[model samples]
Target: MSKSVPSFLQNELSGSVMTMYSGDYGGVEVQGNIQFSINYVQKLREFHIFVAQCRDLAAVDPKRGRSDPYVKSYLVPDKAKIGKRKTSVKKKTLNPIFNELLRYRLRMEHLRTQTLILSVWHHDTFGRNSFLGEVDVDLSKWDFDHTQMNYLALKSRPTSSLQPSDDRGEMKLAIRFLPQVSHSPGKDPPSNKGEVHIWVKDCKNLPLIRGATINPYVKCFVLPDMSRKSRQKTRVLRSTVEPVFNHTMVYDGFRQEDLKEACVELTVWDRDKLASNLLGGLRLGPGTGRSYGALVNWMDSNADEVALWERMMTSPNEWVEDVLPLRMLTTAKTVMK
Candidate 1:
């Protein structure tokens, strides 16, 4: 079907209207549209998107005959780098109201070439999920500094595979490094070693599982060697999206030079009876070569992460506290074991 450009968007487009599709489930057709808001916070260098609601969705259920729909969104071209974000599934409803916020850490220059992709899906419990429809918007054309609300029409999936977004949640932390140096004139200088104090403060906007809240915890590790000895965790908070840790861990016995290569990794996990699920993680360190000071370079394009690294390197003796936004691992290999 030919897509119709909304009158409000006509001025934004030069001469061609963007193509969109109506969602079709088996033979049952429905007119679907998504309502959302977008804004970029300059101080944080992040894009915040709120998926408010989706209406007139196609029913894709086979046995019960009602759809359990959820919305997944991501930035195009570098979908693998930014990861994907998703809303909770609303059971047996064609009109699902998510009201969920997703965030992406990106620079203003990088936003000029990026596109936003939002997809709706039918989540099946007993079988594989089915894709209902999607919407792609050229973010470069939009004014991100000013908040904008959009009612976008849904279309068929642009590609076969979908990359998940980084809407899971975020962690708050305070990192301090104390160098082992002698103050007394006569006393021998202490060994070339220091202590790293890490405080896992809290978490926010965690994802839901099976319509219930998660038991969230923070896991900390000193990287290069993510061995069992270096791993420490906070007590799991029961049934809450916003979890308060306020726990501190100290890593001693390492030269001041270790700051150049060593990094502190903090991961959030949902504590399950059998196996815990990885929610997201944050990495802090010094930039090496072309790599962004943290998390494999590609993930640390935001100003905050790079600034934190600069502070640590330039002022190793002073304490630094930063509210580091957490992001999901782009690939399975990046997941914290």
Candidate 2:
């Protein structure tokens, strides 16, 4: 009986194999399940799994080429002998299934070239303390760090430092999301759930080998009064969720040939007990708007692509940037008032 794995992971692994199997002579292929541990290959699979999940978040199918060229496996070819009569080595051709996988790999590589702007939101503890987040990065910068140095060593460079611009095109990313206090909004909502969707142009838009995580179950303390100590003075609180994020850092072929856009429905919950206690229900904090403000400032001040900031603001659909106004930049640090 065959087991089932998620489509996202399948896309991710396919992309990884494409990234690693590059060479001048010919391409590499996978055969039977048995072999020495292909640790690098496994890493590629894990990264795609994460990419698939994020694609789900954005409601995009980042693995669009799954049905295009197809994928297949074959036995490794034996090397030609020196002394014996040279045998005619008929180059093996890719079956339709394998071609689909190859096409997916190429497509993802293209996406890896185009930079994606990721907007991440953190509804800390509860819905009351919601804050904004985003990452503007170019996927062209990605590469194997170790591989770069080794290549540099062969050339006898005085130094083998990998400069930001060197492979920054592969995936140069940055993230900023404000911590907040909020309450749990039960599963259902009047409209869409409080959650936000996330999608990347390609695997390079992600950080590393797998998906990111948000730790929502941690505990904390909220004090009614700092100096006045009494039974009512302290309250147990839910801490910020620790998120584990990952994506395909590299691909075996150009993006257009291999990967697809990924999508997911947002699933954030409201759980701000502190705000509930004070406001009788969940309410936005005074400084909450500042999160977007700071993001805009960063985009204007730090992003090389200024049009990204502008495009985000004008998106017709209420995108993440739309909810996070660029003017929230004026808030002084931490003074939520």
Tens digits of per-residue lDDT for model 2, 174-248: 211111212445653323212111222111111111123211211111111111121111122233222222221
RMSD of each: 14.4, 23.4
* Candidate 2 accuracy as TM-score: 0.17
Identify the runs in model 2 with alpha carbons over 4 angstroms from their true place: 1-159, 163-301, 318-337
Instruction: Tell me the lDDT of model 2 at 234.
Output: 16
Question: How many residue pairs clash in all the candidates, one count each?
Answer: 6, 95
Superposition error at 69 for model 1 (Å)? 25
Model 2 lDDT vs. the true structure?
0.18
Q: Model 2: how far is 39 from its true place, Å?
A: 36
The local lDDT score (0 to 100) that residue 79 gets in candidate 2 is 13
User: Looking at model 1, which ten-residue stretch has the lowest summed lDDT?
Assistant: 10-19
Q: Model 1 RMSD to the real structure? A: 14.4
